[model samples]
Target: MTVTASIDIASSPEAVRAKFLDFASLPKYHKGFFASLTPLGPVEPENKIRVVFSSGQKMYAPIEHNTPTSFAWTGSIPLLFTGGTKFTQEEVFSGALSFLMGENAVARKFGFPEKTKKGWEGYNNDLKAWCEAK
Candidate 1:
């Protein structure tokens, strides 16, 4: 299943890009949803990053940044009772920024599709507020 969320920020695309690249500061706005975001190493197309959820579940993914335009990552969570779920998340910045999320059938079966869409909408709202404030 695939879902997307988008918002227009009262800031330039360049400003939003700069803020987005500062991965370390993500938790400042996302703290309620994510426990923490840690970079495994330097930023690169395939750089691995660790994302810890508030529930203590950990996920890892290779991140790709397309300069002042977009970034994306694919990751998964192991579900002992039902195999696992694979997901691809992308963020694109134009005059606005959009969040796209895609998950496998297994994930959809477990209701991840709708949850992810709502989650992205909330996250993007916070992101828009942050960017506009700067």
Candidate 2:
């Protein structure tokens, strides 16, 4: 299963993508969702970065795609899950256990999909605001 969210921003894709990649500059306008980024090591053509969220969760994802209009990284558990936490470039989440991240009892108890979706929504809005302001 996979979850995705999209938002249309009144800015060029290049401008938006630039801000998204600028993780350190994000907190100023993106609220506190993105805290900081620590370089783990050289990852060949692209390096992996550790993104620390305001919620205190740290995600170490490798840059998989970086172009003028889109950006992506793979933070996965081998065969289990992968998440990038885009716009219509839509941030994605997928895994074998992803089905459990629905409206089921346990999912509701833990706010799996809801909280995750909300986080993406907030992220999209923040990105939009920042890009438009630029």
Candidate 3:
């Protein structure tokens, strides 16, 4: 399942990229994001970073796509999550949340209905607030 959101931001792609690179600033606006972001090292597209959640869930992911206008990262599997985040600067700022539960896991683990969808919705709303804020 995937949940995505987009909004227009009156800023250049470079400006948006700058903001995206600043993961530590995420929680200040993205309510659903980590309570705090700790940069372990340089911010490269393939660099891995640890995300410690307020709820004490620690997840890690390497930057999957990083460009002058966009960036994306997929959560590290069994230890982290299934999907990650994406941003695009084509008139509107866009964000996406996707979960790829393997067939075995889906059938055995998270068989809970509506749980995943709700989580994604919350994530989308938070991203919207963060990106659309003036």
Candidate 4:
């Protein structure tokens, strides 16, 4: 299932898209999220970026359909399921939530776990607050 949520950022779409493109800078504002990105080597275009977490979970998505109003990513999540841990679970679910939302409004109505949905709500709220504050 997909859990999604959206916020109407007060900033223009260009600003929103710019924020999205500045993923590598997230570590400055978002604690614990180590955004490690690398070009997809010779196999893909430069726009194809692979983002890895400090937790070892990785997400690969192209900078698809980038515009002043929208930014989208199409990619698969990697998993190495073993036993279990809080960090692992959080990483997997957070990755899924980010993929589903893509920071869009319609995703607010997407269905998923109640906790996950609430988490996205909080995320969207945070985004709105940040965008509106500046």
Best-matching candidate per lDDT: 2
* Model 3 lDDT at residue 14: 53
Candidate 2 positional error at 6, Å = 1.2
Kindly list the per-residue Cα lDDT of model 2 for residues 36-71, writing each as its tens digit.
755566432267878787789888878775555445
Worst 10 residues of 2 by lDDT: 76-85
lDDT of 3: 0.48
- The TM-score of predicted model 1 comes to 0.66
- Per-candidate Cα RMSD to the true structure, in Å, reads 11.2, 5.7, 8.5, 12.4
Instruction: List TM-scores for all candidates, in order.
Output: 0.66, 0.74, 0.53, 0.50
> Candidate 1 has which clashing residue pairs, if any?
none
Error of 4 at 111 (Å): 13
| Candidate 1 wrong stretches, greater than 4 Å | 76-110
- Cα deviation at 22, candidate 2, in Å, is 1.9
Clashes of each: 0, 0, 0, 0
| Candidate 3 TM-score, true structure as reference | 0.53
lDDT of 4 by residue, 8-75 (tens): 55666555544545655555444333346554643223366676755577877664444343334455
Sort order, lDDT high to low = 2, 1, 3, 4
User: Residues 67-114, candidate 1, lDDT per residue (tens digit)?
Assistant: 435455555321111112111233332232122223445555666556
Could you give candidate 3's per-residue lDDT for residues 1-64 as a string of tens digits?
Answer: 3223343444454555555556767766666535555556776666767866556778676866
